[model samples]
Target: MTNTLTDETSVVLANDPHWWRQATVYQIYPRSFADANGDGIGDLVGITSRIPYLAELGVDAVWLSPFYPSALADGGYDVDDYRDVDPKLGTLADFDVMIAALHASGIRLIVDIVPNHSSNRHVWFQEALASPRGSAARDRYIFRDGEVPDGTEPPSDWQAMFGGSAWEPVDDGQFYLHLFAPEQPDFNWANREVRDDFLTTLRFWADRGVDGFRVDVAHALAKDLTYPLRSHAELEEMKLVTDGSHPLWDREELDEIYAEWRAVFDEYDPPRIAVAEAWVEPSRRHRYAAPTSLGQAFNFDLLLANFDAGEFRAIIDHNIQSVSTTGSSNTWVFSNHDVVRHPTRYGLPDDPNRENAISKRWLLHGGPASQLDAERGLRRARAATLLMLALPGSAYLYQGEELGLPEVADIPDADRQDPTFFRSPGVDVGRDGCRVPLPWTATGSSFGFGAAGAHLPQPAGWGSFSVETEDADASSTLNLYRRALWLRRDLQDAEELTWHAHPSGSDKVLWFERPGGWHSVTNFGDAPVELPDGEVLVTSAPLIGGALPAAATAWLRRQAR
Candidate 1:
């Protein structure tokens, strides 16, 4: 018998009381964060060791990427066992220790929850595969025979995100659906049994004392009206599936599902935080994070906010306007395990200024190309870090980013772990670039990760961009990140500041004013720009320079009222 909440006493309509709103969440990709056992992988114990660092960095919470038992097909995104921790990342007891340690440091621990699908190797899927066609357990997955109908000849044109058909032929006479990799099978959320099993999984984690969850691809759970076999073969397999314009990403469908989850959260007081990973447009971002729905939906507007001042300004304006209208806590993300670092995205390469004597001299003398690139990259990296921490909404800092980690240089095809890279074979390398192990020390085969090789190779430039080197230097990118984060935490109005922004110049340079007489001037330009007269607060580059220094940014305190 379960202790289900009664409607009368449950108060299902209650709002979320979790302290996730406006709280900075630091996302930790477990496998690459730190390797403690010399087993070439980061473990729960390793993550536990970094909890105090997160606290010191002023992040209110930590969101651990999937550490559950898995075959590592999609880098742990494909979970074979939900209840147990993967041996590579440590045991269930190790997880408990990490959770307790994080909590002790006043940092909430949010685990990743992949409810939309499980690995094909999952026991449920394995059993379903072995069971008879008409079995109830088999019905928990979308199984269709032959081709289904659509407006066109081929079944409904639903293309998989990674390319090719969304349906994969299985042992049975039917095909199973997978929005992502073929190894990850989609679950039939419409099925009551499936829902019950998922709810059980949720409860299992809740009992283990997880503070919250970042639901992976939450909107991808629901499929479109079209039942597709395969789409056209040309240009990326062009599958004509419902792209959220139709009923696929509809609010009603998501709301109905979330209502059930909300009930689960209500059952446990100090309501567990639920942040959705739905990358819909900015206008629709709030639909999933409605007061009655998930607490927050990561806004990729920041991801799209690159170095262009115009684009960055529009992002801030859009967020401010949308949050005001929807009355929902705005969530801001600059970087994640899945995306490229901001500096790499924004910082443009420096072309030799033929007119400038120094640049001309360097080019004429055949100066090191890599050296020039490094100099340009370092300045841009510093600026992006400043801008990321100053943003008004609840921000997410990806692991290793604080140390100014750059994208992985070049790992061979066999070494690459991202399924997207494997499937596409260099067409799009996917997220493996950003998931390299953090560089802890400047020297050693493991960069002080452990006695053995790292789970993922440290970026070739790790020595120059390492935490150990930066921590000892005040002007380093790591120190800048630490200072900016501490400043965000120390500000008395940090919690109360209402985000307000105007067109500082072009949309590229965003000029935002916080409630407590603070001004954030961001120049996403490849060249420097002037700041409005006040006192120059903190800048990635010297304010004396006319140019903002290609992707330079700064936060200033507005003059006293």
Candidate 2:
């Protein structure tokens, strides 16, 4: 629920102030993108080797997930060293080569920067542990003496976002706070040393030629020192609290912290871009996107939305108006490394009222495999993507999205690595399914993902979805993406959408126009709908009898009347 500009940011103008307004950025999970030197892992060399492929994918920029030195406790987010590249990922020289390659291809790069917490293996954390209580080292992090009277219970009852208690007690009568995994401890943002060090980290990367940064957990960094223990029911309400004074999320102090970071970003040429992955309430979103602060915040309402036309319309209208206040472009996204792939999520039976709502349980508690209609899900996914791409602001494409990949539902529990899976003690299978290594060829040990085996097992027959196979098929989802992205460039113009009445006069079908002759129509209903009088530019699926089919979308050019 982080309002992180995750749902926002696409293109950039490193030189032109408004490049991000209309760019199509691709997110690459290095762990799963491509593997070079095999070691059963993806690395910087692999990412660099694929620069030409990304150039061919029609993306305007690349948003890389963290590749810093880490224990992989929470993938790479539990960073141990902010200034250095992970030895497994590659060296600093490799990072420079990768950035150089991307720049040469006319693509911008936005590296992820994690400021909320640091891996316990980090020097600062270790130093804090070895130092005596109330020392300067411990002061940099959130360390407080436990509850009074021999200090048995925790200082507060704050539970970790993943699972279990948020307070990890040491031998002494003191406890440390970790909103996420125990391996990752939250920083004391109120401490000037902690704040100053982050400014150093930000400058370290910006000096490396990284165009911008995607701030991880952008909304969770600032916290109220008062550990107010609330009821369990109330604590579970929202990803980010918006009701009254919340101690853990979206605090008034966060804006000032971002403003400081914004000042550092401004030190760069043309000013570096930054998007907050803050998941705050819609009303509070503008604060994160304020021009003098982080500059952009992600609108995640669409990612959490069901595929209903009304839901999509409402989300679009809300986001467009929400970001308008801060003069930030609306951002749209469907899936990412954290969520279940959209194709699979959309495949669930449309009956939201069904007794079985999606939960952390396997299959997302989304009913039996037979109940998941894969065809319907893929169809809706294609249509939904077209709708997202046709919107005014920028859009993000997660790796394997173009291949129409679904959640790898049956990964062996023993092979799972996400902290949630371990923390949930197997109740929640975690995000490993969506983070599985990608298939790149029709046949190979790792589906051409790498010369060696992939760390995570690739599903059988997944080769059919490989880029190699899709490139040859005119009807493959990959080809559809290629064509759609190609055609979308001509359609991306207006800063807002002008809703057009559907010819079928049904609210289930949506029609909208951008300035130019470009227009888009989508049929979310069960029946086909007549398209406007325009030349068909591109469609998600084949038209049925010259009408847009159910669960489909189309782009067109207005014909001369």
Candidate 3:
């Protein structure tokens, strides 16, 4: 494979049967990507219009966050119809057209599948509400009689992932479980109809030319039948339990479900695939990524790592080892719709408990306290991007990361829409900051995101980081991404990564070499470091006196010894 970019077309490497292994995937949050109709919202047409930009970005595939028909509860994660597109997004016909456009541009399309739950407005859920407590319709969901005779209390005290009780009472007096929002009811995967429906849904999309599916909350589909009561202390500990011992999450039953889904995916000519959004422990992740189940599971350790070289190297090594056991590729990700942008996170002071602080109200405020030096953050983010791309597996890039977009932490409360925010009020800032609409132009009503209003507010200074601004600058983050991705094609089939030891034995810099003399060095310390003897190909920042600057990364082709 040779790195080549011609007329905005990426030409490199023959296709591998396991293309996802070492593939660069870009995630598009539909409503925030682009708006072609100027309807104050982004739609399928908005994405279709940007297919050229995506191909130009040099990504192998584009994974769309749920654009399915929904009540906008949980940002479309609460799906109402699995087979159709949301009218606000576009019709099913529009989705088909977009699929064709993406494939035409040498890109694969991956859509999100929220199998764990459905909108309360879904027909099955509505029927469950209308039917008697013990009726067949009610059986499709986790409906149980209330704890007391009056049925006033929920079946058991369980907390929703967003906030509040997991159980919602209906007029029929039976309580149903929803691990997320009340509008998003958890389905009874135990029901034969529920399991079969998901298989059909998989086929529906696979038949439409979608290359893959990003299964939302993939580990939460199957729950313990007993619905055991868990104490507050146990609940807190459950969040960190990766052993799958928790009653509700990472249950063994999920493996069977994925196997069935994989079977459906295998029916296709090229064979479709799925990636699990499972948050289970690293040791248990292989079950989800096994060849018989989902082909890949997102390795979020990188997302949770602090801006330290040692921490990142450890995470990378562990993820690669874990995924290898399953004969699957390690899926690396830095930022996604659910968390704060990596640039902002890297800028903030490192706290040992930062993971737990993600949902805290003070962190969500997105105030001065929530931010640090912006320039420093961008430098580290750029370096991180290079490090991620140089690794030997699939990398998921959130939409605006290429442009070095920061979190819009100051989104006004009234305009906030994440269920996590409303569920807890001012206590938790929610995920809206990272979900703000993207900017294409340096100046516009919504930074050219739409003709007029955008669903979420865009910060005033965001224009400076817009694509138009970065695209013109040769040294901009956007260009770095473009060049790195173009170069990445040559390393796609690389299966080994050997860490290079610094002569000074410093832990502040990460050095690694791949096959074909491709080496990457990233400096996470305060001082500059000497680069290995090689031809410098590209860098996250300019070299200072031939030394890799602090918070910078340099890719090189090793000189013959």
Candidate 4:
């Protein structure tokens, strides 16, 4: 629980400029993390109060989801004001105090920066709406004239990510573009004033002692400006294309913007850093972390991969190789606020379109998965966690994953708040299931999350996974995470990873060794496997008669030959 890093890790951190290359960061969804002042919403003070818990959790840094002034239209991704804190969350003074406390705990803070778009309520957006179509104010956003003289049709046929027309009509007969939700209007980054404003916003936080930022929608900032319509097939392929012709995403011009931001980052002491939430192809993903841009980007291939050894190994290898030339480190993530909790996903029966099925129907009424699937999911989730943590490079852990929390798939339709659900209406249930408030105590009005009701309902059975309940049991997922994190402190920042040959020569089992005599093995086959000749550091499940059980992972200190 001590804040001090081990001597070995400390030495590496002191000498290496890129300390984040192997750092373990914990992602916090602010509203769901903890609630203070009985307001039914989490705030800066709530986060400040939990620093001790985070320090004890053994994370090097905490990446908070957006807490800026917002309407909560897209879980705060629709930012209204970049320079100030939301009154509901707390004042800027509270944020300063929280930053100091986290630094005091030896944990860094990374705030979310939503640069691609601003809330419709943002002052700039308001001015743009009130101004003429060709006025200077309108130039700050992507406002354009309609295709027809009557202005009945949209300017283009681009579709929104949340399932609607990307363009929203205004009173002036012009339309503005918003790739996600209509509440969030995409900024015209080509405008000098918009660029200057964001730079000022960055400096504002850096001067306040905030460590870094996680740039939201980092790949979509720069648009091609041609306003071309894409075919349905082309739209589908855009998500995975590299050096693609897609006009709205992963455009080459984004690198210039990142370089400009990186220059601003270098002006401060210790040099602030950024991580991108980009969904570029494996070949081009590293550009966001090029030497002159943000230093790291989230690698979501691991999250999307099926629970198979070959798929995982292929993703790991491809990711590690992708960033090798950029001097940027690879980032691994399993579950996040946007995706279904991995436990629930892993427990479902495999389908050719498993990802799509899980995405659209995991939380729907009469969905495929059941309670029995949940038990199997938890087992695989535990094994996946150990395997992910044991891998090389940086890793990100979502807020409640340590408690083995499953997606609250049965949330009532009336209680759902995600914009995606509202936009699509019954087609996509959205992300509210994964964003439910955390349960800190075994019993409380809202499981100790708040004195009042939570914004999203916590399932009745969540008390079983509460911090208090898990902390009392050594075999609990919470303790497993603590033990793994503490043991991982000894792991060196080595780039080399060699896959070990399975004794049975089966593809279901995976074995790999790090350069410093650290080894990790996972069993996905139907039966248990004999442990290699090494001192077992940690195992996801209890070993049976000296053999590791199926759906289990073990980390070990390899014995000398």
lDDT of 2 by residue, 205-230 (tens): 87777778898998888877764566
RMSD of each: 7.1, 4.3, 3.7, 3.5
Best by TM-score: 3
lDDT of 2 at 5: 18
- Candidate order (TM-score): 3, 4, 2, 1
**Which stretches of candidate 2 lie above 4 Å from their native place?**
1-14, 227-244, 351-362, 365-368, 559-561
Return the TM-score for each candidate structure. Answer: 0.85, 0.94, 0.95, 0.95
Model 1 segments beyond 4 Å from truth? 1-18, 148-157, 224-251, 348-374, 492-509, 524-537, 545-550
**For candidate 3, lDDT tens digit of each residue in 1-561?**
121123333233223458788889999999999999999889999999999999999999999999988889899898888889999999988998898788778888889999888999899998988888778898889998887667799987888889999999888677899999999988999999999998888877877777799989998888875745776467677777766677788988887888898888777645677899988888888998999999899988888878888789888888878877899998888899998888887777776763732643365374655357778878999999899899998999999999999878888889999999999976788898888999999998999899976899998898899999999999999999999999998755567898988766889989998988899999999999999888898999999999999999999998545
The positional error of residue 498 in candidate 3, measured at the CA in angstroms, is 0.8
Q: Indicate which candidate wins on lDDT.
A: 3
Q: Using lDDT as the measure, what is the rank order of every candidate, best first?
A: 3, 4, 2, 1
* Candidate 4 segments whose C-alpha is farther than 4 A from its true place: 1-16, 227-241, 353-364, 368-372
Q: Candidate 1 or 4, higher lDDT? A: 4
> For each candidate, what is the lDDT?
0.69, 0.84, 0.86, 0.85
Looking at model 3, the pairs that clash are: 361-427
Overall local distance difference test of candidate 2: 0.84
**lDDT of the structure predicted as candidate 1:** 0.69
